[model samples]
Target: MGSGISKARRGLLYISYNGKVQKFMFDRKATSRDIQEQLAISCGLTRLSNVILKCRGDVIAISPSMPNNTPQEPYTLEQAGYNVSANDIIASTVKEIGKQFRQAFMVEETKREVYNRVASIESRVEKDGKRLMEMEKYKLDLVELRDAIYNKQTNTLDYNRLRPAITLPNHFYCPSTEQESLISMARDIPAYNKYVLTNETKEALKTPQFDVWQWEPNEMLILLEEMYFELGLVDELDIHPATLKRFLLRVQENYRNNPFHNFRHCFCVTQMMYVLIHGCRLQEVLSKRDICVLLTACICHDLDHPGFNNTYQINSRSELAVRYNDMSPLENHHCAVSFKILSSPECNIFANLTPEEFKEVRGDMIILILATDMARHAEILDAFKQKLDNFDYSSEDHLNTLKMILIKACDISNECRPIQVSEGWVECLMEEYFHQSDQEKKECLPVAPFMDRDRVTKPTAQIGFIKYVLLPLFEALNKLYPEVEFIALESLKQALNHYERMKDFDENKKKLFAGPVMSKSGRDWYSEKQMVDEGGQ
Candidate 1:
C-alpha cells in the first residue's frame, strides 16, 4: 500500500507518507536538530526533507544506518480515531494544519469584504449622478414653459412629458413638472420687453373718439422694467421675477383707464423710479429690496384712480374718501390694491424675502404712494427744500437724503419733464376734471375751479396758470436738480410762449377759450412750506 503525499515546502514538514514494506513520515514542523538526527539518514540530505516526503511511495524500504544511502520504503498510515485507512500521516506534529487553514480562510474573507465595499460605493455614485441629471432636466423644462406662456401658447405644452410630481425634503412639492417649469422659466424673461416694443404701435392707432392711442405698450414696459430692477437691488430680497410679470398682467387685465392712472401711467412711474434709483444715485442709500418695494409703489401708486383729483373725493364725500375718513383716500386705496395683489401667491415676487424685508417693502411703498397725492405735493417739496438747505453732499448719509429727494422728485416728475409731456398730462387732467364737473352739475352740485365745465375764458386761465403755477414749481425743481432744469424751464417757457402766441387771436380761438379759467388759487399750493408742515403733522 504505497501512497503519495504533499508536504509544507517552507517548513520542511511532512504532509503525508506512504507505506508498502515500511516507511516513516517526518514532521514538517520538526526543528533542524530533530531533522538532522531523526530523519537525516532516511531523508538523505537535510534540505531535501520535503522532497523525500513527497516521494514516500516510490521507495522500497528504509534501512537505518545503511552504507552511504538506501532508498526509503513507502510509508502508509492507519486512522487513529475513525478507523479509516490513511494514505499518509497528517502533518499535525507541529500543529501546521490548524495554522494553514486559518491563514487561507482570513485571506478569502478580506478579499470578499473589499469587493463588497467597492460595489456599494460605485452604486451610490451612480444613484447621485442620476439625481443630478434629473434636476437639470427639470430646470430646462421650466424655461421652455415660460416661453410658451409669454407667447400665449400654453395649449401647446406637452403635459404628458412632464413628471407626475417632484417633492423636495423641505416639503415643497411641485405637483406637475410642467407647472414648475413654466413658473421657473418666467423668472428669466424680462416682463416689460413686449410692452416697450408695442407702445408706438398702440399710440399710433389712437383717435380722439377712442383715446386708447395714448396707451403705449413700450412706455408701460419701461415702467415695469424700472420697478423690477429696483426690487432686485436689496440684500436677501428673494423676489422672483415671475411675480412681477404676473402683477403687471393683472394690472393690464383689470385696469384699462385710457390715459393717466392707467396701465401706461403705472409703466411710466415704474420707469421713473428706476431713473431715480440709478441716474439720481438713490441706489447708494436704499437697499436693493427697498428699491423693489419703491418700484412696486410707483407702479401701483395711482392704480384704479378713476381719473379724478383729490378735490373730487373731498367735494362729493365719495365712498372712497368716506371709507378711509378722507386721510389720503386715493393713496390709501392704491396702496391697499397693490398689497392685495402682492398677497397672492402668484404675485409674491418677493416671496423669498425675510419677514423684515417684506415689512420694509410694505412700509416704503405706502409712504411713497401716499406722498404722490397732490395735496401732499406742497409738503413734499418743502421737506425736500429744507433737506437740500442742510445738505451734506459729502456725508455717507447723502444716500438717505437722496432717496427722500428722489421719491418726492418722482412724485412730481411730470412737472420736470419735457414741456410736451407735461402739457399732455395737464390736458388729460383738465378733461377729467371738467367731466367730473359735468357730473356734479348733473347731480345738482356746486363744482370747484378746474372741475366746473361751464365757465368763461378757460384757455386764458390755463395760460395764467403757466405763469403763476407751473413756472414757479419748475423753478423750484430746477434749483434742486440743475441737470433737469433745462427740461423744466423749456416746459414752462413753451407753455408761456404758447399762451402768448394765442392770447390775442380771433373768433375760433375765442370758441376754443370758451370755458371757465381752469386755474384755481392753489395752483402753486405744492411749493409752500405750510404744505410740508401739514404733511409732517
Candidate 2:
C-alpha cells in the first residue's frame, strides 16, 4: 500500500440521488464496486454490474493505489480533487439534511398549489364559454323573430303593427319599381347647373308668378335639386341622391291630386322656403337645426290634406277630426303621415342623423309644420307680431315663433307671387274650396265661409284672403326680412288691384268680360284669371 498514509482512513460522501441525498462511507482503498455495494444495500437500485461511483464528478478508480511516496502523488481527498475529510460526517450533519428535506417538502407543496390554481382558472373559462353560447342563442332568437315579423326581401311591411323602432326591419331600404322610377326623376333636377336652369326659375322665384297651374312637376323637381345642392345639403347630410329622390317621390305620391293642397302646392311652399332661407339670408340667422326644420316642414306640411279646412272636418265629423279631437286635425294628420313616411328607411332622408340629432329635427319640424293650419293663422300671426320689437334670437320660444311665421309665410307665398301666379293659385284654392263645398252639400253639412262656390266668387274671396290673411302675415314678416317684404308687397298690390277691378264681375256679370289667354288650355285656363272683361264701361 502507501508509505506514510493509512489506506483504511474513512470519509463520508454525501450522494445526491434522484431528488434525495444519502451519505456513503468510503476509504482510500475502496474500489468503485465497493460504493455500488453500499448503494445496493441502501437503495436496492445498484445491483447492476455496470454501475460506477464518482466523488465530486471525477471517477473513483478500482486499480491498485500509487506505490508509496512519489512526491507528486495525491495524499488526501482534497488533493484528489474532492473536498472531503475524515471528519466530514460531523461537519455535514443531520441538521443540514433536515433543512434540505424541508426545502424539498416546500417545493412539492408549491407544485400542488400551482396545479390547483390552474384547474380553478380552467373551470371559470368553461363557465364563461357556456354563458357566451347562451348569449349567442338569444341573439339568434331575436333575429328569427324580426325575420318573422317583416320580410325585408319582399319589400312589404306589416303596417298594421308597425313600431317606430323597427321602421324598416333591419334598415333595409327597398323601393318599389314604380317608386324607383319616380325616384329616378327626382335625381334629374338641375343640381347646380346654373346655366341649365332657365331664367324663368330664377325670375319666377324672384318676381314669382301668381298662377302656379302652369308650373309643371319637372320644373318643381329641378328647383328642389337646385335648392338642395345650393344649400350643400347633399354633402353635409351625407344623403344618397337616390334615397332622397325616393323620399321626395314618396311625399309627392302621398299628396292627393287636390286642386290647391296638392303636390304642386307642396312644391310651391318648398320653393318659397328656399327663397326665404336663401334670399332673406335666414341661412345665416339660423343654425343647421333651424334650417332643416324650416325646409323639411315646408315640404311635409300639407301631407295627406283632405282638400277641406279643419272646421269642415270638425263639422262633418270626419275620421281625422275625431282622431285628433277636432283640434288642428289636418295639421296633426300632416305631421303624423309625414312621420310615417319618414319612419320607412327608404324614405327617411334623415336616417344618417344620430338619434339625438333626429330628435331635434323632429321636435322643430312638428312645431314649424303645425303652424300652417289656417285656424291657427291668427294665433300664429299675433304671436310673432307681439314678439317683433323684443325678439330674442337666442330664446328658443322666440325663435320657434319666428320659424312659425317663416313657414306660414311660405305656406301662403302664392299671394306674394306675380299677378298671374297669385291669380292661378287663387283659382286652385277656389276650386278646392268649391270641391269641399260640393262634399259638404252631399253630406248635408253646412258649408264654411269663402268655401261656398255659389256665394264666394274668386275676386271677393282672394281679396278677403289677401287683406285678412296674407296682409297681416306678410306685413309682420316684412319687419323681419325687408328683401322679402318688397316682392310680397308689390305682387300682393298688383293681385289686389286686379281682383279689386274684377270684384264687380259676379257669375252673371262675367259673360261680357274678355281677358287675355292665361294658358294653352283655352277658356277654362284663363276663365279664373280673366277678369273685368267688360272693363269700367
Task: List candidate 1 stretches off by more than 4 Å.
Answer: 1-215, 226-236, 256-259, 276-278, 392-408, 415-423, 456-474, 504-537
**Mind giving the per-residue lDDT tens digits that candidate 2 earns over 219-281?**
565566666666878777777876676677677766666667778889888877877776688
Candidate 2 deviant stretches above 4 angstroms: 1-215, 504-537
Per-residue C-alpha lDDT of model 1 across residues 16-133, encoded as one tens digit per residue: 3333333344444545445434554453334223222223344322222222223342233222232212323443534677888899999999999999999999978987897899
Task: For model 1, give the 10-residue run with minimal summed lDDT.
Answer: 164-173
| Whole-model lDDT, model 1 | 0.54
State the RMSD for candidate 1: 29.1
- TM-scores across all candidates? 0.51, 0.57
Strongest candidate by lDDT: 2
lDDT of 2: 0.69
